[model samples]
Target: MTSADGKGPVVVKEGSDALLPCSLSTEENIEGKLFHWKKDGQKEVFLYDAGVHYNNGRPGQDEQFKGRVSHFQDGLKHRNASITIRNTKLADRGNYTCDFPRLQNQTFHIELDVGAAAEPSVTILDQIKDWALLQCLVRGASPMPKVEWKDSSGNMVPAHEPQVSQRGDGTYDVTLQAAVNKTDRFRCVVTQEEIYHQIYAETNVLLPPPPEND
Candidate 1:
């Protein structure tokens, strides 16, 4: 990857879209030319032949990117050759090279990093004497997120370590149990360390109803 100008790698969430940066110089007064985007020793990320995008089992194209790649036509006139990758995959992580035929210094090399899921579903499990057991679970994440319990004051709560399990699809499934005092609002936060992404689910301990005045 180029990594030039302190352009760090782009982090994209899985199952979402990603943009690969590239452009040609309009100062060159070029009419139209071929552009190519390919993965390192893997396959062609995208192929533009004389302003036409080729696919449908066309040569020099990879199946992984066949229906997922598209360009911004209006930007093309402004020397923009960037492509968008829809529904990103974990396998999409790596280097991507964008080049224009016969154009000098018109290549953009970028590295893509796929982030994991960070939303956890939380619920009140059981209410015991003075406290309740809260359960939180998040699935379909890579590298397993850190599941934790926090109070409304932003203080970490003492909770059991989450039970982490790997799914058949190569993702992770995690469950954490926490005990919370009634009348307190608690949050279950799941953090993906790779991208420093954090998402949380909130729940509250229900206080007992007041007695009726007779």
Candidate 2:
């Protein structure tokens, strides 16, 4: 799909194949055209043109990207020279450019983050003797994220003590406090709609009671 803005870098998950969309405003016959894909400072990793794969005919692709690279068929229709990299690896993280032979040059840069998916944690702590403190934590998220608290009924519970704070490491920590009740089920929802495409992670926690000995 087209990017939200006309220009910028796109971020994708590691280990998963990503499609970088590129559209040209110029009208030209891209059929039987030569398409080349390569990293910014690297040689051509894959090439296709004249309805055939040229990388195999030429010097061949790099040993690292032997069978992991392919051109997007539909991309040629709208002047989209996107490439699909299968089984993406951490080393594949870098900028990419698509060169159209005898047509035009287009560059699309991407950043791939390879690591474990974010893990969300919910903690219930008692504060002010009667208020229940619900904390939601997510690690390794860029651009921050939106946090919300909801009850079992799927209704948004009003929270007066909700705070969003940034950790020293640049991660995010959200805290929402509400009156504690034995029957209330509080859920901490962490969403990064833009990057993750949905709620990255969430957790449900129950408020515990004070110690009887106290």
Candidate 3:
């Protein structure tokens, strides 16, 4: 079997459905054959044999994946062993293996990466004199995220140390502050390198002109 991307980890956001692709490379039918899906080579994710499948009451499915996984029966004739995991969580990130125990013990490996991500909220907290204090907030993100300020020209803006806090739900809340002396479009970028996810929020700040000399 081969993964859909053929290479690299499959990236997905938390709470979203993730499709782990696995299909026979020879394009042979596998509807009547047996294939097993496992996570980290231990936990049973799903299994299929002939017409009986894990989702249909076949035993041995890991508790974490039970009632949340499904296979494409219509595609079985096409040799597709892909499975969709609904409402994916951060813990779903791991290496997966699809094994065809009936087909000379053929096995294929794939990596799954799930991230809890959200776009930061940017706003002007206060404005005094010619400069304004801008705030960027990212709430309820897992594995945390790197937050930074940037100008319209893509130049990195210097800012104070970000205030980070962990919520009771195991997610993180981040607050970043920057003071701008000129008018421009400022953006708050949030990146989660582990899952290859990135998002940003932008706001326009207009400063009043300086007073004229007497």
Candidate 4:
């Protein structure tokens, strides 16, 4: 119903179906009413009129949404107007609005965050003394995610500033560095706050063997 943050957007896995919830708490019958759904600046994501789904509405529905949008019609009496978008894509990452014009404050909105981030990985960029210099990478996630490091104890580990860049595909690549002591097992975690989507990778960092002396 809600994410851990409560304020974060609803996170959904890439290529997976996503639901944008909207319900009128009061008695609202939308049988023939113009119940509309849309993303900002985009064509109608879905429309209900004359007891028919207008996902194929004229004026050209966005091709990306064809045949993948649906609503809960059975709950019309209960005012359940939730919609599901199947096989969601990165482009679906944004705010959505669903509303009933006949009622005041009937506009319900939600955000969809999609995560297709490749497997997270850690590389030993360098090492010094008891600290093993580590580099963590989170590749290709939409809405851009924040990366953090944690120790085996689940405590937040100290990490240097992270370097994040956007790829041509509109996803993001994030790299961060941490110094893990020999006794530490560190994990690199990436999270998309809007949807609260997260993925993590772990690595055991051991102190490098002492330099050989001739």
How high is the CA lDDT of each candidate model? Answer: 0.78, 0.58, 0.88, 0.76
Q: Quick one: ranking by lDDT, best first?
A: 3, 1, 4, 2
Model 1 agreement with the true structure over 91-191: per-residue lDDT tens digits: 88888888775766466678887766766899998997677899998987875788889999989989987798898766799999988765788999888
> 1-214 in candidate 3: lDDT tens per residue?
2345586778788988999988887757888999999999899999999989887777888999989999999899899999999999988988999899878888888888787886688889999879999999999887689999999999999999999999887779999999999999999999998767899999999998888999
Clashes of each: 0, 0, 0, 1
Candidate 1 global TM-score: 0.69
- Per-candidate TM-score against the hidden true structure: 0.69, 0.59, 0.74, 0.68
Which has the higher lDDT value, candidate number 1 or candidate number 4? 1
Candidate number achieving the greatest lDDT relative to the actual structure: 3
lDDT of 4 by residue, 43-73 (tens): 6788776576665444445677888888887
Name model 2 segments beyond 4 Å from true. Answer: 1-15, 22-33, 41-45, 49-66, 73-80, 87-94, 101-117, 127-129, 157-182, 200-214
Task: Report how far residue 15 has shifted in candidate 4, in Å.
Answer: 3.4
Q: List per-candidate RMSD values in Å.
A: 4.9, 6.0, 4.1, 5.2
Error of 1 at 172 (Å): 4.6
Candidate 2 accuracy as lDDT: 0.58
Q: Model 1: residues >4 Å from true position, as ranges?
A: 1-6, 24-31, 55-60, 104-107, 123-133, 142-146, 152-155, 160-175, 181-185, 191-198, 202-214
Candidate 3 has a TM-score of 0.74
Error at 54, model 4, angstroms = 3.5
Q: What residue pairs are clashing in model 3? A: none
RMSD of candidate 1 to true structure, Å: 4.9
